[model samples]
Target: MRYSRSFIHTQYEVPKEAETPSHVLLLRGSYIYPAAAGIYSLLPLGHRVAEKIKKIIREEMDGIDGLEVTMPVLNPAELWKATKRYFDIGPELFRFRDRRQREFVLAMTHEEIVTDIAKKFLRSYRDLPVMLYQIQTKVRDEARPRAGLLRVREFQMKDGYSFHPDFEDLDRYYPRIYNAYLRIFARCGLNAVPIEADTGIMGGTGSHEFMLESAHGEDQFVVCTQCDYRANTEKAVGLKPAVKDLSANPPAMASVATPGVKTIGDLMEFFQTTEDHFLKTVAYDADGRLVLAVVRGDFNISVTKLANHLKAVHVDLASEDLLERHGLFGGFLSPVGLKDKNLRVVVDTSVGHETLYIAGGNAVDVHLKNVLPGRDFPVTEQVDIAEVRSGDTCAQCASGRLDVRRGIELGHTFKLGTKYTAPDTMDVTFLGADGANHRVVMGCYGIGVERLMASAVEQWHDEAGIIWPVTIAPYQVILSTLGKSPEVDDAADALYEALRTRWEVLYDDRDESPGVKLKDADLLGIPLRVVVSQRGLKKGTFEVKVRRTGEVFFFGRDEIEAAVARIVADLSPSLDGLPLLPEMG
Candidate 1:
């Protein structure tokens, strides 16, 4: 591509609303333009990067015999209704009614639609195992979208689904896709770590997320240094400390009159005790029912875990009206002396049966002390709902302290079981060897092409600009004409022509100063840069530098082609060698 003919634009000043480095750099480099808070338009440069990532995904998907297919962006509400997602997906689903008054949805994922296809086509046992994939656009109504491509309302994704006869077959095929995901990220010039993750709205028994660690990432996850245990914070588990011995002499529970103290900090300061000594009870409205979620004051509740436990579509802190309706005070409510049978309670295991605690008095400006679980308050439905913190002991090995990092999700794979293929859902079936009907076990895999591109910049950029990985850089070589010397221009033109014949090269043929051209080259992050100047031509050499390492090399005009060949070979042998889509004959 020639620079003068391209629509590439660069900005000197960053946008005021840009928060993350990827957001600022993408805008300044003219790779993306903001359309709204959560929506963006990918410019030519951004489209090229997305295409590169898509090609890598296609290569890996095709290698695994994945049949490529395209599903509609607008899905019928009946399909989602069959899967119960039409109501369960909440406001994130883009739903509307058509002219005929039939409801429809813009799909966030295609599980129901894909399984419906399987139901219509696959009829025999021979079709028990099939993998179908598509590279298509998906839409979700993000409430608070930010971080550029990391959290967007609409974007392109490569989603794949596989069907199997039984759990054993899916178990065998799951690892194949897992390994393929690893290869895809590695070929894209990213170091993504696959960690155990909550399936969330994608209801599955198990799932894994490929995460690229970045300081500006929105998702928090934990990694074990001594072992292979890692998970998203929502699903992360840590060793439970031994319960404190409180049986020496059981103190009677007593209510104390305190004035103007509602928060845990104030209670801790008033009593001069650690946070864990107090029991924090939070009231929530889950599926229209008021429930109290109790945990240690030191830890915050994992809302995801709480919602998942209740199988609720949405959960939020109880409003003042809802709490008042249930005869519950906002900041002074505890499980003890609760007369409302409708008010349910879920306790965290961190508050054991014998552990004594300081709790709310169910009255304003009052608190109870020396209260014990199972004695003062019933211990019902205890689970692990507390957020894991840094320096906590690992749950699996119980030796290493858990280290947390922020990460962007690059890929997700789920063992969906029969969630989509159950008889009442999509109802997909196949004939067995004995001519008996059976449901298909399903698995889903997804990768956001643009998110992977953004994560690459987040992982690889330096102070100057994006340090593109050699495998997926927009162009392997950038040939620049430094000055107005006719001889230097002619030499650069010859080299550009020669290199374009065999390599993906970008020639800076615009009438710009050497400083501007070099700065733009760095911003674009081409892996290899070649400069043509009269001074270097007089020295029988042209300046060549590797963008990643900043190592400079001088090649005589006569030896220019050989030097480029050597450098390309050292960095990457051929564009063909990089993972790419199958040649369309």
Candidate 2:
């Protein structure tokens, strides 16, 4: 590719809408152009990078005996309705009516369509296990899409699904996909950690997400200091210290006057006690129903865990009107003496049975003292809903403390079991050797192609620009002619011809200054940069600079090609030493 005829456009100033490093660099480098809020168009250089990433994904997926197949971008709404996802999912799942008045949907995922295909074929246990994958586009109506390709409503993805006869077969095959995912990321020059994650809209028994730790990430996770325990905060657990009994014999519940003291800090100061001595009751509206959640005052509630526990489609803080309609006070709310039969109350396990706590007095400007769990309020259900914090003890290792961190999800694998193939769901079945039919066990894996590309930029970039790995860079070498001398131009033209045959070369033959050409080379982030100038010609040598390290080397004209070949060979990332999975407790 020659600079004079290429479609590359770079800017000196960052765009106003750019938020993260990847977003700013990508837009300034002319790699991507925003068509809408959550939509983008990949330019020439960006398309080349995306194609390289897709090639790597194909090689890895094919290595694991995966059969490639292209699914549809539009699907019949009946397929989604068969799995009950059409109604379960909200606006994110794009739905519309065709001209014939038949309902259809834009594919957010291919699980339902794949299951429908499986039920038509694979009639016997002989075809027990098979891996099918596709590199296709997916659509989701994101409410807020930002950070370039990190979070987009429309993007390319490599989604794969596997079918097995029994749980044992699925369990045996799950590790292969996990290891492949690790190799894929490592080859892309990223060190992503696999952490246990929650199965959100995709109902499954277990799931793990590959995360690359970044300060600008949207997801928060925890890692053990002494062990290999890692999990997203929404699904993480911690070991709680046992609460000591405040008194030898618990005292009876009594009312206390707390005028104008509504907040936890105020109540703690009024009673001269710690935060754990009080009960914090929060009201929520889960699927249009009122729910009361109680936890120790020192802990905050995780809305993700609360919604998952209640199996609610949506959960948010209850409004004042909703609470008042249920006869529940905002600051003085309690689970005890509730008259509404439809109200649901859930308590966190941190509220111990023996510890006496100060709870709401069910009235304004008042509180109850010496309130017990089972004695004062009924123990209908108890679970862990407290958010994990830094310095908390690890639940698995018990001896290690957790360190909270932020990361971006690069890939995710789910052990779906029969969630989509059960009789009550998609009803995908196969005949077994025992002359009976059974639901096929399954697993799904996905990697966002654009997200991976952006994450690589996020993980490996400097003030100059993105430092692309050699394997996935748009071009391996950039040849620039520094001076207007005809001698330098002749030398650079010859070098471009000689290198283009053996390597991916981008020749800068434009009528631009040396400073502008050099800065553009660095901004493009080619692995090796070759310079031909009159000064260097006088020295009987050519200049070579490594973009990643900024190290310059001078080689004789005859040895320039060999030097570039060797450097490019060394720049490719290797995955020989990576483990299949990180250590786990």
Candidate 3:
């Protein structure tokens, strides 16, 4: 492609609305244009990049015996209703009424619809263990979409679903998907880490999220330095260090008037004790039932873990009216006398049975000292619902400490055991060898095409512009003709014709200055750059430069292709030195 005839637009100034590095480079490079706050229109350059990503995904999925099929983005609300996601997913689902007043949805995902299709086709166990996938568009009503492609409302995704006759078959096939996910990211020139994740709203038993660590990421995960233990913070578990026994005799329980003291800092200043000695009681509305959760003063509750434990669809802080009606003070709440209201109580695993600690005295501006669980208060349930923090003991290897890092989720795979196939959800079933009907097990895998490209930009870019990986670059080589000499232009055009036979070359034949052309080349992030200039022609060689390493080589006119191949190999050395998977010979 010649830049003179191409609709390529590169800007000098950064976009004011851009927040992250990928957003800045994508907008300034004219790869994408924002249609709305959370929606974008992919330009020619971005479209080409997205197609390359899709090709990689298709190859990997095909290698795993996946059959590609296109699913409709506009699905009837009845499909979601079968799985109860129509009501459970809340406002994020894009719902509307059609001309006939029938409700429909712009699918956030295709699990329910895909499962229904499987039920209609696969009747007996002979038709089991089939994988179907699609590369399609998905839309969600994001409340505060930002960070460019990282948090978009409408985007392209490659979602795949697998159906099996038994749990064992699904479990055996899961590792193949796991290894395939790693290969897919690696082929895209990304080093993504897979971590244990919570199956939220997907109704799955287990899940894993492929993450690319970045400073401008939305998800937080912990990676163990000692072992292979890694998980998203929402699902991560850590050991609670055992505390030493107190040396002094226990003090008698008494109430103290704490006026104008509401926070933990106030209590610390008033009593002059460490934070661990205070018990923090948090009140929440778990599916509209009031529940009191108590933990150590230094720990914060993990709401994800709490919601999973309660098995509730929604959990939020208790409203003021709900608290007042339950005879619970705003700041002073305890389990001393609320046992009559059937309020649920969940204690943290860190709290000991005989440990005496300070707690709320059930009255405003009041607190109790020397309160002991199982003695002064009833202990019903204890769980590991506290948030995992830095330096916490690792749950897998009790010796190693935990550390947290931010990451962008590029892909996810879930082991959905009977969740989508049960009688309650779509009622998908098949006959077994014994002639008995059973629920089909399922698995879901997904990759965000645009976000994958954006994550590459985020991790690979430098101060100048984007540093696209060769696998997903719009073009492999960009040939530039510098200076006003027609001889240089003629030499560049000939080289472009020759290289186009073996590579995707972008011939910059535009009447632009050398400075502007070079800056745009960097912003576009093509791997290899070939320059045909009068100075180089006088030197009896062409000037070649590697975009990522800035390595320059003067090549003879006949040695251009060999030099380009060598540099491409040096940049990426996998599967015959090609960026994407090598074609089967």
Candidate 4:
């Protein structure tokens, strides 16, 4: 592709609307253009980078027996209705009407469509396992689209689904895809780690997300340095409490008068003790019903964990009316004297039995001191409600301190057992040796193509511009002629034409200063750059520089091609046991 005809416009200043560095540089470099608030146009340079990432994905997916296809952008509304997700996937989904006024939806995901296809084609155990994938655009009505390509309403992705005979088979295939994802990220110049993650909406038993570490990332995850235990905060495990025989040292339940005290802070100050000496109890309305939530005084509650417990789309602190209806005071709500039959009380393990603690007094501006669990108060359920902190002990190895990190999810894979292939629900089946039929287990994987690009920029940029990986730079080399002399122009033109067959060369034939041209070359982030200057002609030599390292060397005109070939050979990552950037037929 010739640079002049590529239709990608160049710019220098960052757009004021862009809030992040990746967004600013990406748009400024003409890699992408905003089509809408959350949508973008992948122009020539941007599209090539994305396509190169996609090719890496293709190679990895195919290594794991993946067969590619083009899935539909619009799926039948009935297919979703049957799966109960038509109404389940609410506002984020883009719903519309066809010409006949029948309701339809742009495909946010292809699980239902894939399941429907399998029901018709997969009949017996002989076809027990299958892997399928597609690279396509997905649309969603994002409430807020910010930070450029990192979070978009519409973008490109490679979504894959697989079917197997049993959970064991599903397990066997999960790791294969996980490793493939590692290779994909590695080839794309991303240093990522696989962290245990929530299966949300994908409806799977377990899942893992490959995360690229970035300060501008939206997801919060915890990584333990001692052991390889990493997990998204929403699904991260907590350290198990050391087994305490709370039955001994039992403290009896008794209420002490305390005025002008309601919250944990008030009680702590009134009692003249640290926060751990008290149990903080709060009430919330889960759906139409009331549930009591208790945690350690110093610990902050995790809303995600609380919502999961209630199995609710949303949960909020109980309103005064709901609390009064549940027979609790508005300002002073306690788990004691539990007379409300419909209300449920759940307490965190931190508020253990045999420990003297303080709680609400069930009356406004009052509190009860020396409250003990299983004695002064009887809780109905136990939970881990507190959020993990930076210095918290590791749950797995117990040696390293747990630390939080911000990361972008570049890839995700899951084992979905019978979630899609249940009988009459997509009804995908395979036959047994004994002539019996069974549902096929499933696995799904996803890669955020644009997110990967944004993360790459986050890691590989300098003060001037992006330092792109040679493995995936938009172009392999840039042919620049710095001076206005016709001889320099002839040398550059010759180099451009000669290098076309061997490389994707960009010729800076425009009248620009040597300094200006070099700055633009740095901004373009091409791997190898060659400048034809008048002085080089006198020495019968040309200047060659590596974009990643900014290492420059002089080479004879005839030897430049071989030097570039050697650099790409040594520096670019290997794919499929082959040299990097093997020319596509």
Q: Candidate 1 residues 1-585, lDDT tens each?
A: 998988899987879988888888888888899988978998988888888888889999999889999999999999999999998888899999999999999999999899889989888889878999999999999998998998999989999999999888888888788878888998888877889999998898899998888888889999998998989999998876745859788999999887987667788888888888888899988988888999987777998999989988789999999988877788898888998865789998788766778999888888999889998878868998889988889999989989999989999999999998887788888999989998889999999988988888888777778877776778888999988978988888888988889778989999999899999998888888999888888888889998888999998767877887787667752233322223221
- The clash number for model 1 is 0
Model 2, stretches more than 4 Å misplaced? Answer: 581-585
Query: Relative to the unseen true structure, what is the C-alpha lDDT of residue 257 in candidate 2, on a scale of 0 to 100?
Result: 92
RMSDs, each prediction?
3.5, 2.0, 2.9, 4.1
**Model 3 segments more than 4 A misplaced:** 246-249, 573-585
* Angstrom error at residue 356, model 3: 1.9
Ranking by TM-score: 2, 3, 1, 4
Q: Give the poorly placed runs of model 4, Cα more than 4 Å off.
A: 240-267, 282-287, 316-321, 327-332, 423-425, 574-585
**Position 571, candidate 2: lDDT:** 84
Per-model C-alpha lDDT, please?
0.87, 0.91, 0.88, 0.80
> Which residue runs of candidate 1 sit more than 4 Å off their true CA positions?
569-585
lDDT of 2: 0.91
lDDT of 4 by residue, 198-256 (tens): 77777779998888788888998999978878888888766734323345555566667
The TM-score between candidate 4 and the true structure equals 0.91
In model 2, what is the error at residue 564, expressed in angstroms? 1.6
